[model samples]
Target: MPAIEVTSLSKTFRTKRKAAGLGASLRSLVRPEFRTIEAVRGLSFEMEPGELLGFIGPNGAGKSTTIKILTGILFPSGGEAKVLGYVPWKQRRQLAYHIGTVFGQRPQLWYHLPAIDTLTLFGKIYELDDRQTKRRIAELAEAFEIEDLLETPVRKLSLGQRMRCEVAASLLHKPKLLLLDEPSIGLDVVAKQHIRDAIRTMAAQENVGVLLTSHDAGDLEALCKRVIIINHGQIVYQDKVSALKRSFLTSKLVEVRYAQQVGADFRIAGTETLKVAKERYGVKLRFDARITPVGKVMAALSAAGTLVDITISDPPLEEVIAAIYQKAENRE
Candidate 1:
């Protein structure tokens, strides 16, 4: 059976309309206008065990709503879903034992308590034995490099230090499924690498299925093989990361810095000048898949002038996503 399966799952939230003034706000207490907002509309997908999938979308795209349904924090209004052979909404109590969740915006640790105290609390809540809890704590602390932070109070630790403890706290139950929402948010380069490495190691050793949501494409590039892109509460694209890039992007961006001033004709054939500076210029050029490869980027710029330096950049994931949204808007 698939580790996670959803068929036309949907969620609609009823929002109350409140007026601006205090009189109107007080009046709302007597009677309120209700608006039904569909957060997730007819979404469906399946994932196998031990798979690492990236779920990404713009704000108001219903990414969080869908995750809430899959993790059993909220009920779907239509269709159905099965995660690990159990209906998530109906079997949340049972599912909690095997699924772990980490929310980047919220710390699971208690502020005044030491990091180890939070782990102990989680151990009791999950009903783990003393021996199992100790072993899991040791393993995760070592892997996450939070051994020093264990004795420090949660509120006193640095953001990166606290994040490490948070992740370690969530995994103390030995969950089979891990749900991470923006786990790398606000992390610096070195801290981001450490978190990504820890995630990769856990997924490999524990054989857990991970569903990660992040605004950072670098996180997806480092941890996930497959990605599901959502827009306006529906799936826009679902495919391998490599295939998504290859199929959606038709052009590459090249930035060049010249030794001296160059004429307008110095531009590449069939390329557009995105921007030009005193001694530097950026060009957008189409690549015919087989004709112009990455290796030829510097050489092509050399033909234009005495090239000082040249760099090739892939189209940003945001650009590809915007293109998809524009296509949908046009069709609509």
Candidate 2:
């Protein structure tokens, strides 16, 4: 059986309308207007044991709602979900024993308490024996490089330090599955790198199945092998990371620099000419997929002027995701 399986899962939330004026409020006490919003609509997917998948979407895209259902924090209005051979909502207590969750915005540690204390507290909550709990805590502290900061109060630690502790607290139970919701939020370059490295190591060494949700493309690129993209409460795409990139990619941008800014009107033979914009430093060319070998484009540009620097890149993922949304909107 798959480690995670969600079939036709759906969740709906109801919002009540409050009257603005006193008289209207009094009237609303007798009868109120309520609207039901389908936050998650018939979403389905399955993950094998030890698979690492990136779950991504824009705000209000049902990513959080799905995660909530999978973790047994919220009951789904429709469909079925099973994690580790147990129905998540029906077997909440049993499922809790096999999963670890980390949400970036919330810290699981007490403000004035040292991280070690928090881990110790969680060990008791998990009903872990002293020896087993101590061994796991020691190993995690060393692996995450938090040995020096374990004694410091959470409120006094830096963002990176606190994050490492949060991750450690979740893993004290040695859960088979890890659910990360924006684990890299508000982290600087160096701190993000540290967290990403730790997550990768955790997965590789422990064989933990991970379901990660992050807006940071860098995080997805670094850790996830497969990506599942959601939009408008639906699963629009799900596949290997490379396959998604190739299927949705529209154009490639190349920036080339010459020793001197070429003033002559120049064009590459095989590529769709997107018109060159020349600045004092270099020329930027936007090309289409019809462009033959990138090597040919490079050679043609080199012939025009001494090539100083060259970089070829894809369009940003945000843009690709937006395009997908627009297409869906047009169809509707």
lDDT of 1 by residue, 107-132 (tens): 89999999999898899999989888
Regions of model 1 farther than 4 Å from truth? 280-300
> Scored by CA lDDT, what does every candidate get?
0.84, 0.86
For candidate 2, write residues 167-196 as lDDT tens digits: 888888989999999899899999999989
lDDT of 1: 0.84
The estimated TM-scores of all candidates read 0.91, 0.92
lDDT of 2: 0.86
